[model samples]
Target: MNKLSIIIIFIVCLILFIVLSLSYTKLGTFDTVISSYIQHFRTRPGIYFFQCMTYVGSIRMYVPVICILSIYCAVRKKLLNICFLVFNLWGSRYLNQVLKLWYQRPRPDIHTLTTATGYSFPSGHAMNAAAFLGFIAYLIITEHQLRLWQKTILLVFTTLMILSISISRVYLGVHYPTDIIAGSAAGIAWLLLCILFHQRFIQ
Candidate 1:
């Protein structure tokens, strides 16, 4: 997308984040109900699948990919791409930490299917996955030469990747749906900001 479109999206996401944050703070009935509903549909295989996806979204997985990508970028001397990637991934992570602290929201009090310890206003996995995959999708769609089908597949895959990771966080009982929504908004906002800045000043 173009700069204007990205800016608009960023604004929309920020607005969404604000709305969700408010609802979450009040513990909206819908939030509680949906959280229950999502957890209710859980199956053994589904748990395994999402757990694996959550692992893929984890810092453990992203760290190596970030290192390898950064090294390749360094070797190729692609400074702009390197900066954008780091900002979208690593910087977004650090920003999420600040946000979690600022909000000081607590995780669910239910029995968790997985373990995670942190204030859970915004899910780290959800944010990081959104930022990383959103950036990759932007790069692929804008910088590459591909057929329409190829672009469609990439977009679809990116969407699924983001959705799966976010849903996993909720399903695992570590995050509420609002937390994931807020996290996604925060992540995509940062990603779009980086893309817009990179385009205007670096490109």
Candidate 2:
């Protein structure tokens, strides 16, 4: 996408975040309904599945992947790519923390399938999944010269990864549905801004 298009999307996502934040009380009903519905279908296999997906979204997975990618960039002498990658991931993580502290929203009172401790307005896992994986998808699309079939496969896989990670938080009962939505909006906004800056300036 062009810079202007990215900027517009960034703004739209920002507005979406703001709207969700302001309407959180009303959203709470929807959140509860969805959470309950998801929990209603919860199975032992589903729990195990989401547990793995949640771990994939965690820093445990992100840090190593980022380190490896950074090293790859270094070996290839792609300083700009290295900088953009680190800045995008680290910056998004830091922003997620700041937003969590700022919102200070409580985690769901439902029976949590996994242990989690934090203010949970915007799910950290959701933010990380959307920002990091979403950026990886963007990088693959923009950087690689893949065939149409390959690109389609990559896009589908990347999207599933992002959505699975985000939904896992809700499934685990540690985050509300609105939290996932808000985190996704914020993450996408930040990702777009990073891409726009990297493309327009350093790149």
Candidate 1 residue lDDT tens string, 1-203: 77688889999999999888777867667678988999998999989998999999998998898788778778877777777887788898899999999999889889489889889989888899888888877775766689999999998999999999999988888988889989999988988887887778654
* Candidate no. 1 TM-score: 0.93
Judged by lDDT, which candidate is best?
2
Q: Across residues 23-114, which tens digit of lDDT does each residue of candidate 2 receive? A: 88787679988999988879999999999999999989998998998888788787788788888888988999999998899998767989
**Most TM-score-accurate candidate:** 2
lDDT of each: 0.86, 0.87
Each candidate's number of clashing pairs is 0, 0
TM-score of each: 0.93, 0.96
Kindly report which residue pairs in candidate 1 clash with one another.
Answer: none
